[model samples]
Target: MKHSILLVEDEQKIAEGIMDYMNGGEAEYETCFTWADDGDKALELVYENEYDLVLLDIMLPGADGFEICKAIRAKSYVPVIFLTARGREEDRLYGYDIGCDDYVVKPFSMAELSAKIMSFLRRSKGLWEKKSSIEAYDIVIYPDKLQVFVAGNEVRLAPKEYAMLKYFMEHRGMLITRDDLLVRLWGYDYEGSDRVVDNHIKKLRQALGEPGKKIKTVFAKGYRMD
Candidate 1:
């Protein structure tokens, strides 16, 4: 699959250069680049389409890259890299504080930036592979097939229920909030209430039978798969 990236940079020349380098066949995987010249447009694009990674410039017309990164983090776990001319120690620290996966300074070599992107991509791929299929508590989950088996017995589940279960299994020990599930599974455009998450979780647990006890509910919080 071709990985899509959103490049949010105000400088047209710099943006084009980065695009050329990324599309120049340096990486092993195919890449599709989408450019956003302003911060507002960047935010709009992120909400409209899913991206594998985001390259943001610190300086922008409508909003700064830091603000954009913060907004993205609030909704999604997409990898973000700050490509900016601001190379100060405090600036880099702030970028990390706001959850940027990587920070690259201006005048950076395209080769180095490309390597950084590839590294993150590889790590993301590894995580996906690790979570793709998991066997726990006598329950087996095949995320790609959307199938779940308990003690060798196939369990039928609705589409949403399957997705919710897969997400819970992937993040087994994490305290996943309802908003996190909404954003990860339903996307930012979902207009439904948070109660939808609760309903799905209930159905998912019921479908898995005895093994479903691994999915624990934290009162006033969200569900967690043990």
Candidate 2:
């Protein structure tokens, strides 16, 4: 089956290139490329169409990426990939804050874009099919709705924190590395330090309480929730 994609970009050339690569190629998955030059139209398309993924350019004509992302998050968690100019830390953070699933700076390679698309698709599939409520001993993960409730009380978690915890729960007892977490949670263009992962883990542990120590840190490696 072809996976539908909503591509919002004002640039014609770049948009064409992406469409050709994604839809014109002979890949394992099929892609339906839908384009929008502005935010208002993008929002319309989102509500009107059933897209599995959204490739959003931050700078739009009518509506900006941030606004579009916020609107989308209000209704759906369909994976959102932000396309913007590099070196805009604030913009990238804003995208993530508004529930963006990934970020890719401008002038990026088509291969990189395709790889990121596939990665998110895989992650989304895994997340959607997850049990409605995840209970690994005392650690509970509500994968279906992107919520975490530990020990009967819902624990508010950041986007990255939720992704991290979900990954750990899905692969319990596995030794996840900083690189692994960075790539999986933040994607290829992640600029923050691995310390971010540590901080989130610390927060997760604290929220889990009681058996918070269950998330063992493997010295110089990473962490595992066992």
Model number with the top TM-score: 2
Which residue pairs collide in model 2, if any? 39-63
How well does candidate 2 score on lDDT at residue 44? 94
RMSD of each: 10.2, 6.4
Cα-based TM-score, every candidate: 0.57, 0.67
Candidate 1, residue 221: CA error in Å? 37
The digit string of per-residue lDDT tens for model 1 on 161-219 reads 87777666545565777766776677655678999888888787788888778889888
Q: Cα deviation of 223 in candidate 2 (Å)? A: 7.1
Give residue 162's error in model 1 in angstroms: 26
Clash pairs, model 1 backbone? none
Which portions of model 1 show Cα errors greater than 4 Å?
126-226
